[model samples]
Target: MRYWLLILPKLPANAMAIFPFILLKKASQQKDVVLINHEKIHLQQQLELLILPFYVLYLLNYFINLVIYKNHYKAYFNISFEREAYSFEGDLNYLTKRKLYHWAKFFVKSSGDRLG
Candidate 1:
């Protein structure tokens, strides 16, 4: 999958966790590259989930976890999809030849469904 990275003017302090868009802030050139890779992983995920549904599911899951866990950061970190993106984002060659279904391995079957 191909992904696009967008940069914005202002971002919240916790933007990395719940950015809600493609913008990344407070990053050096190298860090920006890594962050772009991270967001690219998310873009792949969004595509897998069919765009709008992905964001809907993402927000629902996150809010549910936030209500239960009472910690936004913890909730964000615990998201399996996010975990997969973060885990591999730093790999310089991740986007070069990544497989289409790689992210599916990270899904929690009971809580989430897979798409092709």
Candidate 2:
């Protein structure tokens, strides 16, 4: 699970955790463990999805959510994968304790469930 991190000031997002790599908007942000944890969660997810499909589904879901929410930020935040990562990135040991397909739960929200 070794990954290379590249810092690009013009990166579209704050950071991206693509499989085998992480792209950051600033080199200084590398020291943020919480951010790293968030990306690592994405790595785990990419592996679970066998790499390629993760990106495809990510884009598809983002577009769909974008249409549903009609806002870029809302679409990104409401993504189930983002939901799971943001919900647990602060817990460094989350991956060890996480169950297979645990992220699926975020996608199956109840009527009361909504992103903040």
Candidate 3:
């Protein structure tokens, strides 16, 4: 997928994928392959969902996870998109082999089966 990397010093996270743009907190992060791969996974998810709905579902998932986990960090990590990304970020070839809507597996997993 085609993507642009932009450095935004004030971004809350080290990096975030916003469709065609991958926003980074620092320019140096561009060299971080694992981080870039993680955001790339998000980019694929956004593309598959057609952007807006991806954000809506992402927020909804975060809120639901917030209620379940009662912590911002835990909620963020538990988000289906985040879970999918984190699970395979280290595998640089993941995107090439990923199936559409793979995040759904993470979303539908039983709470007891979730990763910590």
Q: Which candidate would rank higher by lDDT, 1 or 2?
A: 2
RMSD in order of candidates: 5.7, 1.5, 0.8
Off by over 4 Å in 3: none
lDDT of 1 by residue, 40-86 (tens): 77777777677787778777767866775678886776566676788
- Tens-digit per-residue lDDT, 1-116, candidate 3: 89999999999888999989999999999999999999999999999999999999999999998889888998899999999999999999999899999999999998887655
lDDT of each: 0.63, 0.86, 0.94
Count of steric clashes across candidates, in order? 0, 0, 0
RMSD in angstroms between candidate 1 and the native structure over all alpha carbons:
5.7
Candidate 2 lDDT by residue in tens digits, 1-116: 68889999999899998779988999999999999989989999999989998888788878978887788888888888898999999999998988877777977785258564
TM-score of 1: 0.67
Residue 12 lDDT (model 2): 83
Show pairs that collide, candidate 1: none
Worst 10 residues of 2 by lDDT: 107-116
Best by lDDT: 3
